[model samples]
Target: MRLEEIARRLGLEAAVAGKGMAAEVTGGYCSDLLSDVMANAKEGYVWVTIQTHQNVVAVAGLTSVAGVVIAGGHRPDEETIARAGHEGVTILLTPMSGFEVAGRVHALLSQTS
Candidate 1:
């Protein structure tokens, strides 16, 4: 699945146009803790979390995540958006909870698999 497709399926709002939209979504990971994501999130995964801090962008770039879906209507701060754009990371916002986003992502990946 592609990042765009996943974003569409989850009704996400893209923060940066076309950024990481073409990246392949190999899987998804949901976690609010940066350390847990850094330790376990697989490359090419779309991360679902409520974290909107600037450092999340750095972690996404380092982990090579396909994109980030900020759940529960959370939007990244100005610095976070700038960092994400600079790092070529996709940031998506969703009104749904993290669990809801995770379930949708899991279903989408499972269908493609």
Candidate 2:
């Protein structure tokens, strides 16, 4: 599924609105630890986390994630938003918890598969 579709299906709002909306979302990974995500998140996976920092955009770029979903109604700071936009990493916002977002993403991916 595409990042835009995931946003639509999950009722997510764009925080940075990067240019990766057309990117394919192969999977989803939920984590707060940056190191864990860097090591484990697959390419094209929409990452679900509460860490709303510029470093999150850097890590997402390194891992080539489809996007970063800020769960629990969190919003990225200005620096994070700038970095995400510069790096072309889509940042999505949601009011749901990370677990809820993960479940929905998994269900959608499963349906597509």
* lDDT top scorer: 2
TM-score of 1: 0.94
TM-score of 2: 0.95
Candidate 2 Cα errors over 4 Å, as ranges:
none
All candidates' lDDT scores?
Answer: 0.87, 0.90
Steric clash pairs (candidate 2): none
Q: Write the per-residue lDDT of candidate 1 for residues 59-101, one digit (tens) a residue.
A: 8988988888899998789999998888788899989999988
**Worst lDDT 10-window in candidate 2:** 15-24
Q: Scored by Cα lDDT, where does model 1 land? A: 0.87
Off by over 4 Å in 1: none
